[model samples]
Target: MSSFRVKGGLKLKGEITPQGAKNEALQILCAVLLTEEKVTINKIPNIRDVNKLIELLADMGVKVEKVGPESYTFQADEVDLNYLDTQDFLKKASALRGSVMILGPLLARFGTGRLSKPGGDKIGRRRLDTHFVGFQKLGAKFEYDSKQEIYKIDGTNLKGTYMLLDEASVTGTANILMAAVMAEGQTTIYNAACEPYLQQLCDMLNRMGAKITGVGSNLLNIEGVEKLNGTEHTLLPDMIEIGSFIGLAAMTKSEITIKNVQVEKLGIIPETFRRMGIKLEIKGDDIYIPSQEHYEIETFIDGSILTIADAIWPGFTPDLLSIVLVTATQAKGTVLVHQKMFESRLFFVDKLIDMGAQIILCDPHRATVIGLDRKYPLRGIRMTSPDIRAGVSLLIAALSAEGTSVIDNIEQIDRGYQYIDQRLNALGADIVRID
Candidate 1:
């Protein structure tokens, strides 16, 4: 097992470029399967989950060539359908939830897709009902082997039909949209996920001859095409990482610049930080966070304690809530952080409390953080990372603490973060990756 050994109480300086969007890359990478021609993708994050998906594609007969450190070219000229039916393929696909998306492309192009129960962060109930039900709307048959926990989807006669998603699930919408792109007739998706990830996927598909409109809205209309051609796409900077850097700089009182962040696409992320009274300057695609002795949490307009909550796209992303919650521990005022989307996310705050932060876990989805006002710096303690976001939050807390800290189960962090230890080391962080 890999662990992160962090020495706390050090100010991190310098700038680091944000990695490519992990969520977006997952959907976009699966999109390569929609065409047989060569697709060149740049800005692909070299993380465990994404790399695993690329390896899975290679196993399924896609020609994957590493053209650059963060770039790849994929050609699905000869997909091995029989390979998908193997136990080996099932074992590989079960390692990450992104693998569930292959079902859409596989069924769309080859009329059948089989997969094992995909694994990912155990944050909450991340159901795939929306994805399977959407496929059923497009003339697909969905079956499950309860014994093996496997899914078999067949879309031999997929025809376009309208679908209003139960929720604006990011992965579910992307999967169904990919399947609909080449199906017969038209497909109208109401309440579609309008996150940048889905928008990028639609843009790439449209460039490949698929007629899709409503790029940045909850409503999407996709016209089926005979096939999608090869296309090139580049990923935007990861907003979650940018937010994490902002929180890191605040908690550690360090001057840090996050390079090349697309400020436009980071809808409510910056403002959310501002609401916490954190000082930040947005300079033409970069975020400059000045070191501060103390950052205060703001009150509501009617003079109530501030509350930060998560919602769908155009709202505060759920991914950054963990970072914000940890940063709030050292701020000057108390604030209530309500993680409405997931139940178990707020549970990690107990770990922060163990590190000398004053936080009240009101429920599974909400917490009231009473800031320490920088009076008592947290002392490092041994801890285990629960999930991807929480893992990073603990690391930030450990860095802000006053002693040495060891965080176990760091592979959870590796699944999303690419070369995090090496990247932070360049910024003067004393983080040693140990096995």
Candidate 2:
């Protein structure tokens, strides 16, 4: 397990560009299987999870070519359906949470898809019921082999139907939308996920011949097409990473400019950071965050304690809550971080507490952070990364801390961020990868 030896208290300057959106990459890659023509994708982030999916597609007989830096052309015309039965395929598919998305395109085009229980962050229980149930509603036969921990789906004659989702799950909505695009009739999905990435996927599909209306709304109407053609798609900058950089700038008192951040697509991210007292200016498509010695958390209009919580689209993203929590450690006031989606994500607060942050773990779903106001800077200590978001959160904490900190299991961090240490180092951070 590789570790990161981070020297803390260094102020970072200059500009950093966020890589392609990881969440969108997973959906876009899976969409490549829906067409036989060449689909050229640009801005592909060179990260572990995305690369693993690409490798898996190659193993399944998809012809992949690197056209340029951060660009790829994929043709899935000769995908080997037989490979799904192989142990190698099962092992690889089960290891990536994003692999579950392939089931939709497979079942839609080829009428068969197999997958073992998918793996990802152990934040909490992320059930696959929405995907399977939506498939079943569209005339797909689903079966789960508990002994083998595998899912088998067959959708030879899928007919579109109207259904209301129990939860507005992003991946679930994307999976069902992909399948429904090839169904026999019109498919109306209510309470769907309207995230910017999902909208990008919808737009890309529309360009490829799928008729999807309600582009940025909760109600999505997909008119099934006979076949989809290949189209070019460019991924948006990762909003989560942009949010992380904003928090990093404030926590370490750095003046960093994040370039080409797609400010409009960021939703409530910039405003949320501003609510935490971070001063950032939006220059066209970029975000410029200035260094500050003190940032104060905002209170409610009624003079109540400020509570930052995650909601569906248009609300604050849950992925950045960890960064917000860590950033609040050096702010001027207290804020309650309520992680509504996952219960276990707040467990990382103990590590921050160990670093001298005044945080009270209210429960599994919430944390109350009493800002130290930078009066006493966090002292670095050795720690282990539990998941991807938590790992970055710890890294940010380490960068703002005093003295050197050793973080184990940095592979978790690498799975999401591309060359995080190298990029931060270029901006004056002292992060060394101890292999």
Candidate 3:
């Protein structure tokens, strides 16, 4: 197992450029299967999950070429469908959730798609029923082998229709949308996931000859085209990483500038942090955070304690709640961090509590953090990372702690962030990778 030896209490400085959006890459990379033309994608994060999906594509005989440091050109002109039935393919594809997205494009273009149950963080119950039902609504036949944990979708004579999703599942919506974009007739998707990644996918599809309207709204109208062409798409900066860096700066009392942030697309992320009394300046497209001695949690307008909760897009994401919880450990007041989407995500608080943070685990989905206000710095200790987000959260906590801390199972962290230690070290963070 690999671990990170992190020394806390050092103020980080300099500018950080967030890598490509991990969530967006999952959807867009799968879209490469919808077309046979060469699709150029720039700003692809060099991370484990993304690379796993890319590797899966290569295994299926998709021609992939590296054009730049963080960019690639993919041509799916020749795909070996037989490989999907291989045990090696099933084993590797089951390691990441993003692999589920392949079902849509493969079915859309080739009339068949098959894969086993995808694997991901064990944070909550993420069901694929939404994706299966959405595909079925488009005239695809679905069959699941429970014993083998495999899903087989046959897309023959698919015709577009209206679908009101049970929930606005990001991957489910993207998967169905990819299928709907190729089905005959008009498809209307209500309550669709309108995240920036979805919007970027829609934009890329439109550029490639798909008729999709409602770029940033829940209601979407897609007119299926016979075929899609190759198009170049650049991924946006990872909002989760950007939010993580902001919390890191505030927690460690660092002067740092996050460069090239798409300020307009950040949605509710910045305002949520501001609600916790962290001050940041937006200089054009970048976010600048100066050193701070202290930050206080704000109460509600009615004199009640402030509660930060995760919602769908245009709302605070659950991905950042851990960061907020850790940052609040150093703040001056208490606030509740509610993760409505997942149940087990809040379970990481015990580690923070062990490191001297006052947090109350209200339930499976909620945590109330009472700030220490830096009255006493956290005493770093050895711990293990449960998941990707929690690992980064612990890393942030370690960065702001008073002593040395060791975090095991750092592969969880590498699955998302690209070269996290090297990038943070460039900004003066003292982190060492160990085996």
Candidate 4:
């Protein structure tokens, strides 16, 4: 395994371009299975998760070719559905949650799909009931073997109907959307996840001749079509990375510019950061954050304590709560962070607390952080990453600490972020990869 050795107290400056969204790229790659013609995807991030998905595609007899640095052409003229039942495929597929998305397209096209239990961040119990329930609504039947942890879904001629997801799961929404595109009739998805990732998926499906309305809303109306053609699409820039860079700039007192931020698609992210008094200048598609001496946390109108929480689309993203919590440590005030979606995600705050952060872990789901405000720079300490966001947040904290710090279990970070060390090195961060 590789680790990151970082020397803190460096002010990062320069312009860094955000890579393509990992979440969107994974689903988009799976969407290729819906067609036999060649589909070219531009701006695909070179991350471990994407590479794994590509390998899975190749294992199923789909031809995937790299046309450019961050581009791929996929043609699935003959997919080997039996590959889905292999041990090798199941082991790799269970490493990431996006693996579950293949169930929808596979079932719709082949009338059957077998998938092992999917895995990602072990934040909480992310049940697939919504996904299986939605699939059942589309005329699919599901059977699971407890001992093997394998799920089998079978259906014929998926007919569109109204589906009300129990919760707003991003992958669940995307899986159903991909299946409903080629169904027999109209499918109405209510309370669907409307995050930017889902929006990008919908737009790409539309470009391929799928009639989907409500791109950025909760109620999605998908008119099932008989067939879909191949088309070229570009993935959106990573908003989570944008939020991470904002935290990095604030923590290190650095001035950095992030390019191609897709300003219109950053729903409530910029505003939420602005609540921490981080000023941003949007120049066309770029975001500029000036060097900061101190950050101020916004309070309620009645002078009470302010709490920043995450909700569904149009609300703050739960994926960014870790970065936001880490950023608040360098700000000048206190803020309550409530992450409702995941249970154990807040457990990593103990590492920051060991670094001299004034954080009070209220419970498994909430934390109250009081900024040290440069009064005491966090001392470098050895830590292990628990998940993707926590891994990167620890790296950021290590980079802003007083001495050299070693972060192990960096494979978690590598799963999502593309060339993270190289990108941070380009921005003047002193980070090295060691085995």
Q: List all candidate RMSDs to the true structure.
A: 0.8, 0.6, 0.6, 0.9
Badly placed stretches (over 4 Å) of model 3 are none
Each candidate structure's TM-score, on Cα atoms with residue i matched to residue i, is 0.99, 0.99, 0.99, 0.98
Worst 10 residues of 4 by lDDT: 104-113
Higher-TM-score candidate among 2 and 4?
2
lDDT (Cα, tens digit) per residue for candidate 1, span 311-367: 999989999999999999999998999998889988888789889999999999999
Q: For residue 311, what is the lDDT in candidate 2?
A: 99
| Backbone clashes in model 1, listed as residue pairs | none
Per-residue CA lDDT of candidate 3, range 2-96, in tens?
99999999999999999999999999999999999999999999999999999999999999999999999999999999998899988988988
What are the per-residue Cα lDDT tens digits for candidate 2 across 249-338?
999999999999988899999999999999999998999999898999999999888999999999999999999999999999999999
Worst 10 residues of 1 by lDDT: 345-354
Model 3 error, position 376 (Å):
1.5
